[model samples]
Target: MSAFPAQPLYLVANGPLAGRVSVPGDKSISHRAIMFASLAVGESRIEGLLEGEDVLATVAAMRAMGADVARGGDGVWRVHGVGVGGLLQPQTALDMGNSGTSTRLLMGLVASHAITATFVGDASLSKRPMARVTDPLARVGASFTTAPGGRLPLTMHGACPAIPLEYVLPVASAQVKSAVLLAGLNTPGITRVIEPIPTRDHSERMLRGFGADLTVEESARGRVISIRGEAELKPQHIIVPGDPSSAAFWMVAASIVPGSDIVIANVLMNPTRTGLLTALRMMGASIDEIDRRDVGGEDVADLHVRHASLSGIEIPADLAPSMIDEYPVLFVAAAFASGRTVARGAHELRVKESDRIAAMAAALGACGVACTEHEDGLAIEGTDGDPIPGGATIATHLDHRIAMSMAVVGLHARAPVVIDDAAPIATSYPGFVAQAVLLGAEAR
Candidate 1:
């Protein structure tokens, strides 16, 4: 594993960017596809799977838990499941690398089984809060011995004859919700979760695809999801669509720099994950959806984007859950828009691999963009297509989103921007540099 040097990017003003590129598979779906396949009764095949470190961590953890998962020729992956309630203890600790998704989801999967497993990660992931999952899972009779403040490098003790209960999510988190549902798979009766705000619903959709009895209903407070316990999950093939989060970088780039036309193909159009697109549209970005189709229970479409003048608007806090992963790039887009863009209700951004809100604010400020930071969000004043003086070096803090977001800003900056570490980009989106270069972005 080689470390990526402190690469700086240079983008000259006024170049037409035109190309069609397909980003890697959806990170969320890729993680769930491997996990569900590993728990099914038969062999499961996956296509368009992300080979990023996050998804690979799930694959490795599944293999450690007694599943036969392997890569074949033609870029396909196969996983032989151990059936429900058949996970065997691993001989070593499960190293999740930099993936919070892998660490949190696997904790739920192993919580109700008859095994004890320790989870570890890189420095950034170890700092993220895990109490969201551990606190709720503990109510269902699972026990954990974690670091102070419920951080990682923790051990999960499974609850045999697991207790199934209805849990209400205090915050809008898909990981915490999914963790409970995964644990419910081995428990008896029904396990329910009430979400105040709708997060990404990949787990619910995928679990239903694997033949689990899962149901969603709207309530006065919010949405309620119920999963029946002790049910057999049928194995099925999954085709992962390109990640919209990864596509966000190109989308923002194509929107701001003049005379740029780029098409992103076969990207996931899940409503729960399209907040970035919606926010961009609200800013009058020249983006269109083309050749819509359905693939493996997900909506897929090609995004045709062209450069256009953008005007900023206030983004509602409720929309945060859908595009939480994309705020970094969204902030970059706001820096060049016409007015002040205010984003609220984003407390979740604080606990990601890095504090995304703070990171974006700091980076944007360093680059001569005026931004007002909030406890939960930020207010950014756009320059309305004027040249932004950039001459600042950004510390990515080993966060992939931070690195990519800064690169997007360089496309319109007065001077080139430098990021401390570009190495972390491989954790979720490999070939990021090549994809950006194909779209007329210069990276050195």
Candidate 2:
């Protein structure tokens, strides 16, 4: 657990939410930008990076490994990279905070370099399994000593001239795939990954943007991605768009709260991250795309969402990978819909910051919403637009999405809902409550 004290937030039903708002930059892109820039041969400039604690952990880790990283008064971040295979051994352990993305991805980067580093994190992060990453890296000649259950507070000894090999993903995890790809950056020869199920392609896109010799080919087995190791990477300017995950809360909130009409600007519309938008649309949400365009090699658009009568529908299993992070809030939307919402094929949710399936089940039950938890997903019987009983203090379990999702539930509930600790929300959306209040929410 963090040393910080728990900060509770009370939220009650409010009037219509209105106005155009912008969320922070994409966390995934922000982390990648910092990482790729730190591996480039020259200075790289980044615009609109998310300053959240999670992304900052990546910044601090890169700096500790000899990258010159700083944010100027103009709010632009500049990084002077040490080049591929040039990372210096850190003087101390890398504290990853609550970012699993940072810990896993960085483990891959350090695997093929000639350095040894220790990684530590907060209690929540410490419990997450790192073996998925460490296992593949071990095959690449890197060695690790981890806590029991392959958890955090671990040491990794990077391999010099690491061996490159082809590996297949047993699960559909972008993090694991990205880890292997990143480790390939400093290895000799070519590293290949056979992905049976497609996940986010940010690493592939950003890697190419930084001039890494990476290629993707479709086949009967799935997508075969190959990256030539020990290649020179050139620095470039990067602009991060608004995170769709952050925008998801507003999308669902506006859908459930009567009379809500809000404009969310600069949200990334990458197909891999738009499953929530697609899912909500299937549930009869009134969301319109405004000025869809490309920004920084990715699709982005402003969303104009209005309150509509939502109907529960079976969530497609294939859509899980695209909107996994948004499930908590999606459940909130389901709670107010007409009919039943059944979600399956998302067993991956069990190992997140918390068991999201179980967390949402207990939270909704506390608010008098009926839900059945499954090993893979949940089945929720909606109130069909009626406000369910609230007046409950929800345990956030140090999970940001749980806190924010409950806050949304409070907006349409019969009574106020108290979040046990809103502090975790800062790890991703620091201004969530302030923005909620700005949109006419009765939160304090």
Candidate 3:
């Protein structure tokens, strides 16, 4: 395991956080924008793209694979695609760092092309499961020589004449769905994915916008997404909206902290990814949507959040796919609420960069919060108005979400909450500490 500073920062409960904050661009959309732009026929300009390490890794990989990609002024990135089936083999191993999304999706993109590539990553990413993408891609004639148990540090040999197959997602994962669709880009005929539970639809929406022949049909089982293979994708300008996941941290912090009211601007309110907003509303958060509009095919709105008395409610299992990444922060909200909050149908949490369910439970327990962790989910019991005793040091395990979640917990704790390592926060949210400080969160 990589070791960093375990020295903890103390957070004294402060007055209401009053400010307007704009989070960075969506990480998922940023990754796909780079990937799709590199595969399109012309130059694709992207504004408001996330420049985090994870997305930067995608940029480096694209450039290594012979795509012209560079950053211009003010979060603007330009990528010139070689064509649909025109990717060159990389000279070195593609390092995906801590991004599971990048690793899985890139595996799919390289799987159907006529090149061979190797993928490596940091310790946290090396442990993440790759079987989710590899198994499905294998069904469509992509071959992999992976590390034991389908971990990273593996080589993938793309099928020259790729096979097209129908895939039914075993879980509600946008990564899995995107992987199959990307691999199908170089194959012949229609490549279809059946998602019983819809995850984030950025890949589908963005793909359709890029001039791909993509179709979606709703059935009793779930949503069926079909993409025609071997079509030339026309590059276009893309404007990424602020990540709702990143915005969620500030929303939770502002809501539970007394006298706090904050507005997050230009947040993507895609229904497929708005379960946290809905859950917060159910728990008595005074949040309002204002100036709703569409930007680049995503629903954009300003969220007005104010402090209110919150009571916990059972989170529906069906909503897991929508806000999977927000659960750790949601657990923070649960700790400060009244009554019990139970989260189910989150077995996928175990396969993330870390076992997030177990990590959150352990960290919360360390901070004097009562929590019960299951194989898939957790149950958190709130102390009503009692301050959470937070004089504990929790191990972050090099997971960015874990670190950020623990920091959120510190906002309302009687004492300061300290995380063992804050280093991993750079993977997705590079300016997390600065942004949190601006929002009146104390982080050292």
What would the per-residue lDDT of candidate 2 be over residues 336-418, giving only the tens digit for each residue? 99999997788888888888899989999999999999998889999998888998999888998899999999988887888
lDDT of 1: 0.90
Worst ten-residue run, lDDT, model 2?
Answer: 10-19
Query: What does candidate 1's lDDT look like per residue over 27-134, in tens digits?
Result: 999999999999999989999999999999999999999999999998989989998799999889999999999999999999889899999988899899899899
Clashing pairs in 3: none
Highest-TM-score candidate: 2
- Candidate 3's residue-wise lDDT over 162-196, tens digit each? 89879989988999999999998889999999998
If ranked by lDDT, best first, what sequence of candidates would result?
A: 2, 1, 3
The per-prediction tally of clashing pairs is 0, 0, 0
Looking at model 1, the pairs that clash are: none
Model 2: CA > 4 A from native: none
Model 2 residue 41 distance off true place after TM-score fit, in angstroms: 1.4
TM-score-superior candidate, 2 or 3: 2
Most accurate candidate by lDDT = 2
Candidate 1, 356: how far from true, in Å? Answer: 1.0
